[model samples]
Structures are given as C-alpha cells and as structure tokens.
Target chain A: MSSTAGSTLTHQETDLHLQGVINRPYQVVVWNDPVNLMSYVAWVFRSYFGHSKEKARELMLQVHHRGKAVVSSGAREKMERHVTAMHNYGLQATLEEAE
Target chain B: MARAFRATTRGYKADLESHERRLLSQLCADVITMLETRGKQLTGDDAPAGTDAEDDYAHFRRELAGLGDQIDGSDAAGGLAPPDDAALARLLPDASSDPQEAAQFRRLSESSLRESKLADLRAARMALEGEPVSLTEEQAPVFGRALNDVRLTLASRLGVEDEADAEQIHQMAKAGSAATTEALMAELYAFSTWLQETLFSAMLDVMPEDD
Candidate 1:
C-alpha cells in the first residue's frame, strides 16, 4: 500500500520496504494505568521515545482516554526491546503483530 | 513539611522532611527486596555466597552467564512462569498477550530487567539519603524510576486498578494520615503521586521542544 511513495524513498527507505515486505511489522502498545501519573507518562514518552512535547502529550492522552495507544512500530525485535524498556519504566506495555 | 519536586538550573530538587525521606527510602528498599526475591526465583539461587563487593561482581557475572544459557535454550526450565505475587507481577508485566510469547520474552529478559530496576532503586535510595533529595540531570530519570517503582508497589497494595479505585483512595487519603491500614496506604500513595507529578513536570519542562 505504501508503494505510491516510491520515487521519494531514500536508499534506506527502499531497504526498509524490502525488509517490510519480507517480515511483518510489529507495534508497541502502551496501556492505561491509573497508578502511573499523567505527567510521568508524558515525560516517559518525551524522554524514552524522543517524541516532541506535543506528540508525547498526545500519545499520553491517548493512552489515558483510549485505554491504550500504539507508541511505536517497527520490526519485531526492535519492538520487543521497547517493550522491555517500557516495563523497566513501570509502564504496562505489550507488543503485537500490527494489523 | 516536605516540598514537591521543582526544576533547578542544575537539575531537580525536592525538600523532604526526615520522616518523609525515611518513608520513601524504606519503600524503595521494600521493592528492591521483592525484586531480589523474584530474581532468586528466576535464577533458582537461594542465597548468593558472594560476601564482598569483588565477590558479588563475580557472583553476578556467573548468574548472568546462567541467564544467557537459559535464553539460548540450554536449560530446560528456561521458560519461567510469571511472579505469583500480584505486586511483583505488576512491576514486571507480561510483554505479550500470547502466553507462550510472554513466557519466552520473560525467560529471555526478566532477570536483566529485574537487575536494572534493582540498580535504579538502589541509586534512588542514595539520592534520598541527601538532605534535600536533589537529583542531577543524569540522576533525574534514575531517581524517577526508583520513585515510580515505589508508587507501583503502593498502587498494587491500594488496589488502584481503575479510576474508581483511585477516587476511593483519594477520599481515603483525606481521612487523615492513619486511621486504618488502608487509609495509611492511601495517604502514602497520594503523597508518592504528588511527589512524582512534580518531578516529571519539572523534567518535562526541561525537555527539548521537539523530538
């Protein structure tokens, strides 16, 4: 489906397409928890994932209001690492094959 | 009286009274002990014989090597079960919804995760030992992590699984510092919540505006 953006692809993006076609991608999903403070969740998004202040707050709000949010998406191995990192930060995060 | 955390030019600062600091320190220690107990269960080591700093390093290396073997499937019990204790389970949660995948993930990474959390908790303990409970920029997240663990532990005990429970806890906390065990827990939980809110607010303020 991403085939329409072909010409603008960098060499790395082209390589990513090749890999993505071969391997299904995964998403890191962070779930809502009342115990984790809102500010702490937003700070984690900004600090750990390097999301912008706006992006972090948005994702944090999504997790808060929507009960869960996809914080990141990538190869399975990379997403697994992020899952572990989130656990270390005391966040309830899980990984699954992206639909 | 204790002051909430605030951002400083150097890093972050919170003025905690002696009792407050001591209470937080004890909470960190409690979580560390719980994790260490889980660590022992994961590695199947009852008591490490390491007596001193040097010996402990070697002991740690050996255990890590054992964990490496477990990950490689050399050990039959590599796929370990999650912690039965609810509080411990909350701190170290399942990484996948699928049971098999979660077990495999836990087998591969739980020990290291537990160790890293223990390290953070220990560092936070030292940070709390100071009069003002100051954290350098480098130590801010580390301290924040340890503080978060304490909050998680308290939350687990408080049964704060949903917003309703949290609201009930808020009301309980307002019932004075200690009328009952649950009330005491609620107060401590609320205090930790306020402390963490201030710390992360300061941290977020200092962050670069964009990714």
Candidate 2:
C-alpha cells in the first residue's frame, strides 16, 4: 500500500516490506492504571528503556489518553521480559502479537 | 513523624525513631507475607493433597496439563485470571492479553518477581533495624521499590484513582467527618508517596551526570 507519488520504492515502503518478510514482532503494551502516577510511568520508561525524557512523556501521555499504548516492540522473548519488568514496577502491562 | 530521609555521603539516610522504625518494618513484613502467599497460590503450591489414588492421579494429570500448556503458549479458554485482592492486582498486572499466555507468563515469572519484592522489603526492614539507619547506593533502590509497593497497596485500598480523589480524601480527613479507616489510610498513602518521592530525588542527586 504505497501512498507516495513516486513510482520508485520509497524508504517507508521498503521498511514495511522488510518488516513483512522478517518474523513478526511482539509489542509490550502498558495500560493506564489508577495507582501509578503519570510522572512515575514516564520515569520508568526513561530509566528502563533508555528513552529520552520527551519521548517518555509522550508515551506516558498516550497511555493516559488512549487507555493503553505500545511501549516497546521486538522479539517475543524481549517483549515478555519487558512486560514482566513493567509488572514488577507495579504498572499494568500486557504483551500481544504485533499486527 | 517528621520527614526523615536525606541525601548522605554513602547514599541516603533516614533517622527514624524506634516506633517509626517498627512501623515501617511491620508494613514491609506484611507486604512480604502477602506476596509470598499469593505466589504460592499462583504456582499451585497450596493445592490440597488427595488421600485416594484416583484423586491423586487426577491432580497429577491436571498439573501435567498445566505444564504442557505453559510450554506451548496455548490460550486457556478464559479471560484474565482475577487478582486475589485489589492490592495484589495492583502489584502484579497481567503480562499478556491472551488468558493462557498470561497464565504461562505468570507461572514462569511470578516466583522470581515475588522473590525480588521480598528482597527489597527485607532490605528496607534491615536498614530500619540497623544502628544509624542508612542505605548504600545499591540498597537505596531496594528501599525505593519497597516504598513504591507500599504506596501502591495503600492507594488501592484508599480507592485513589486520580488527583481529585486524593484531594477529596485530604479534605475529608481535614474536616473530621471522614471515617477513621479512610482517614488513616489516606494519611498513610500520602506519607508513603512523600517518602518515595523524597528518596527518589535523593538517589537522583547522587547519580553521575551524563557526559
């Protein structure tokens, strides 16, 4: 599904094709929880995932507004690890196969 | 008691009175016990033993099936398993959307997670009991984690959903019309949140700046 005007393959199109060929990634989704503070969630994102402060806040806001947000996507093992870590930190998180 | 935590040469320090130390230790101990109990339940360690051969065989078959499902990552025909209590639910969230996958993940990781939580609580309790209460840089994170857990438990009990709820609790407590349990829990929740925030800031102060 190329949206670009150019007939030649675009970088975005190529990346999508590569992702289709490779093993499908699994995503770790963090859900909004009443007990966890927004600032704390942002801090966890920054500290655990090495995300920058701005990016962490952006993800945290998405979780707040959207009920949940995909915080990380990768191999099944890594996603499982990330979900466990989130649970340890007392955040509501779940893993799902990425579409 | 007064806010006791502060930055220190070693890492972080808190000078709590004997009673305060006892209270903190007791809270941590309670958390440890609850987590251990829940862990046992999750792993089916608390399953009742069967006296008859047929019953024993059935139990064995059930355990074998569970192990097989965990290995294959099959979805158990159900929604998420409900938490034993609100506090436990807050402490341990589901790790996967699929019911079976979540059960498998819980079986694999719940023990280690419980152990780490227990270790953190015990570390905090030990520091509270030690002469000249202090936590080294390494130990401070453990204490922080324990504090976070306590706050989560208290907040869950208090039904603290957002800032507005917290503010209302404080106002009700101040008005002297609130129930004793609600007032006391709200106070504890606020205190724990303050302590956690202070300790976290102290820990951050000691960290080396990025190049």
Clashing residue pair totals per candidate (backbone < 3 A): 0, 0
Give DockQ for candidates 1 onward, in order: 0.75, 0.37
User: For model 2, how does the per-residue alpha-carbon lDDT over B1-211 read when each residue is reduced to its tens digit?
Assistant: 4555688877778766677677678878888888986766555565556534643454455456553332122225422343547787778766876656776676577768778888888888888896457888777767877878887787777887776776776675566543687777676666666666777666554544432
Candidate 1 lDDT over residue span B126-169, tens digit each: 99899898999999999988889998998888888898999899
Candidate 2 deviation (Cα RMSD)? 7.8
Against the reference, the lDDT scores of all candidates come to: 0.84, 0.71
lDDT of 1 by residue, A1-95 (tens): 12435466665666865756646788999999988889999898888898988888999999999999999998888898999999999999998
Estimate the TM-score of every prediction. Answer: 0.83, 0.74
DockQ of 2: 0.37
Candidate 2: residue A44 Cα off by (Å): 2.4
